[model samples]
Target: MGQLLDGKLVAASLKEETLQQANELREKGIVPKLTIVRVGAQPSDLAYERGALKRMAACNIDVEVKELDAEITQEDFVKELKAVNEDPATHGILIFRPLPKQLDENAIQYVIAPEKDVDCFSPINVAKMNVGDKTGLTPCTPTAVMEILRHYEINPTGKDCVVIGASNVVGRPVFELLLNEMATVTICHIETKDSSKWARQAEILVVGVGVPRLVKENWVSEGTIVVDVGINVDKEGKMCGDVDFDNIVDKASMITPVPGGVGSVTTSVLAKHVVKACKQQNGL
Candidate 1:
């Protein structure tokens, strides 16, 4: 049986740490607050917002959700962001992605202050990440991946790690993070030739291509640690990861399952960023 890298268990532990930090801040009369700007009522966005709010409440972090109309003008959205940016109580700001077609997402992202961009979607944070600064709030999903590795006591230092994808959200940031840990990182995209050759040589394999069952059993080496970051709905309407979990489990030393894995850690990591931002803002 493959050893399951249980992200729920890991996330719970991280949440406990965050709760302690929140309490510490509360004692100092500084309440860490997170404000979420959600542009629409898409089911996925709603679900994520609900989950984040619950996590924040459990952590004793103050949170406010700004539900904007889908028809809101781009200028109005920027104005709202400016208000949040200027609010002393709001230490962290998150803008749910894939805004209405008429809105300019890039312009909206730039309006958020770098200090409060806990989502790490702003160009300033991206530049910090690329240059290997540990102080900046990183993209939550990639940070969660690092947290999972730490939870498992699997350091990536000097190891051959293959990240299969180059997306700004998951793939590229993770590759950069692994490199920061001194890992020999190789990133593969859709056009890569014989990608399995890279995977087969990796001590650690991370798949985030967003395609269901894209990484097969033959692509991985025995005893390799596999981290699946993809969450896809199959033709059968079942949720699955990029890796062929059933087939790859026996060959892998450790692996994360889709529904209960990386997705579970993401929100908690975001909450942690809020706490970090609060600390930095207070000079604590």
Candidate 2:
């Protein structure tokens, strides 16, 4: 059976490190704070808000949640974001995306200050990340995947790494991150013919396609290190990952579970980014 990559342990370690940094900053009379700008009360947004709040609290970071109406005008929304960006008290900003049809995200995507754009929503951070710039904050989920690999000491250098997704949020950034680490990276998307053929040859496999149990046992080879970043509800209403864990566990060398895997570490990465932003903003 493959060894389970426990995300809770990784989360705990990150939280502890962030907490220590927060405490030190507090001693220097600087309070690290994150502002979450959310429009409407999306259940998915609420769920992520709760997790971020909990993680921030654990790290001794202050959080401010600004809830806007779903029908708020784009001009008004941009005003609110600008207000937050100009606030010295706000060290980091997290904006829930996929705004209402009334709002044009493209117009305001770069409005958030790059230093406070903790989720890499700003194009500046995204560009920095694409070039392997360690100074900028990266997307939380992809960073969590990298953290899991580090925690497990799974070196990607020169390894055959296959990422089963091409999303800017997860797969693409992960591909870049692994490539930065000198891994031979291949990214497969919806148009890729015979994804499994590539997957079977990977020494490391990372899946974030959001399809439940999409990667079957045949997709992975023996001793493959599998990282499932997908979180979905199976037909039975149970939560699951892209890889069918039960079927692939015995064949893979190491695997991450659905609920306790990448998702669990994401909030911690958010906290880490906030702390980092705080330090940079304060010139610490």
Candidate 3:
């Protein structure tokens, strides 16, 4: 069996580093604060909020939650977001996505200040991330994947990397990150032909297509490093990753489990971003 990439241990290490930074900022009389804007009460959103709150608290960062009504109007939502953007006290801002049907994301994406957009919601941050700018905040999920690899000492440089799914959030960003590490990256989407052929060629495989168990044992080669970024409920209502862990474990040299993998490190990445935003905003 392949060595399990333990995200919990990586997350703990990141939290420890972030906590130290936050303490240093505190000594300089600066407190890092994150404001979370959540609309309605999505189960998933609430669950994430709980984890974020816990992580931030552990890192000595403060959190302010703005729980908006489910039927909030676009104008009101934009107004509220702008208010948060302009708040000098706020160091980082995180907005739970897929806002109500009435509140269009495109119209509001730019409302958050880029400096405080800890989750890379702003186009400015996205552009910076695309260009491999280190000053920008990256999407936490992709950063978590990188953290896992870093923790495992898995260098991507010059490796044959295949990323399934090209969504802006995880897949594309991961591809860019790996490329920045000098890895030869191939991104596959639904329209891509012979995707499995690409998968078979990968030294590092990142699956984030939201399809549970989409990658089978034959999809990977022996000694391949697999990172599953998908969180989906299988037909039986059980949580599973994009890759079939049971069958692929032996084939992979290293693999991350779903619940205990990338998902676990994301909150710590968010905490780390909040501290970075705070330091940058304070000119520290």
Candidate 4:
């Protein structure tokens, strides 16, 4: 049986570190703040928002929610983003993603200030991340994955790392991080041929495709370190990860379970990023 990569434990440690930093900032009369700009009433986003609120409260970080109507126009959405962009009180801004269909998110991405955009939504931050620059905040989910690997003492150097998702939020950024760590990295996507062959080649496998249990037993290779970044609802309404936990557990060296895995550490990373942004802004 494989060991579970306990995200709950990692998140707790991070919260402790963040809490200390927040307290230090408080003593200096600076309160770190995170502003969540939620445009629509997405049930998923609301659930995540509640989680983030609880997480931030634990670290003593203040959260301001900008809840907008779902029927808001694209121009209005842009205005909303700009409002937060100009708010000097907000140290970090997190916009709920996949904004209403009418809104051009790519265009809005450039509107948020890189320093205040803890979610790394701004083009500048994304560019910085792409070139391996550490000057700006990285996307939260990818950072969570890196934290898990570090906590578990999994060294990526000289290892073959296979990333199974290509979205900017998780897969591509993770591949870049692994590459920087000197890992030979390969990224698989929907169009990739015989994707399982590539997965089987990984000493470290990271999956973030939204399809539940997309990776099965056959995709597993002995001693593979599996990090399932996907959170999906199965036909039975049960939450699961990209890699099938039961079938692949015995075949792997370690794995992150759904609900308690990659998902757990994400909000913690958000708080960490907020603190980072606050310090950078205050010249601390």
Each prediction's Cα lDDT score?
Answer: 0.93, 0.95, 0.94, 0.92
1 against 4, candidate with superior TM-score: 1
| Candidate 4: residue 55 Cα off by (Å) | 0.4
Tens digit of per-residue lDDT, candidate 2, span 65-167: 9999999998999999999999999999999988899998888877989999999999999898888888898989999999999989998999999999999
Error of 2 at 222 (Å): 0.5
RMSD of each: 0.8, 0.8, 0.9, 1.3
- Candidate number with the higher lDDT (1 or 2): 2
153-225 in candidate 4: lDDT tens per residue?
Answer: 9989999999998998889989888886788999999889888999999999999999999999999899999
Q: Note the clash tally of each candidate.
A: 0, 0, 0, 0
TM-score of each: 0.98, 0.98, 0.98, 0.96
Cα displacement (angstroms), candidate 4, residue 283, comes to: 1.2
Candidate 3 off by > 4 Å: none
Q: How accurate is candidate 3 locally (lDDT)?
A: 0.94
* Residue range 17-83, candidate 1, lDDT tens digits: 9999999999999999999998878999999998999999989999999889889998898898899
What is the RMSD, in Å, between candidate 4 and the native fold over all Cα? Answer: 1.3
TM-score quality measure for candidate 1 = 0.98
**Ordering by lDDT:** 2, 3, 1, 4
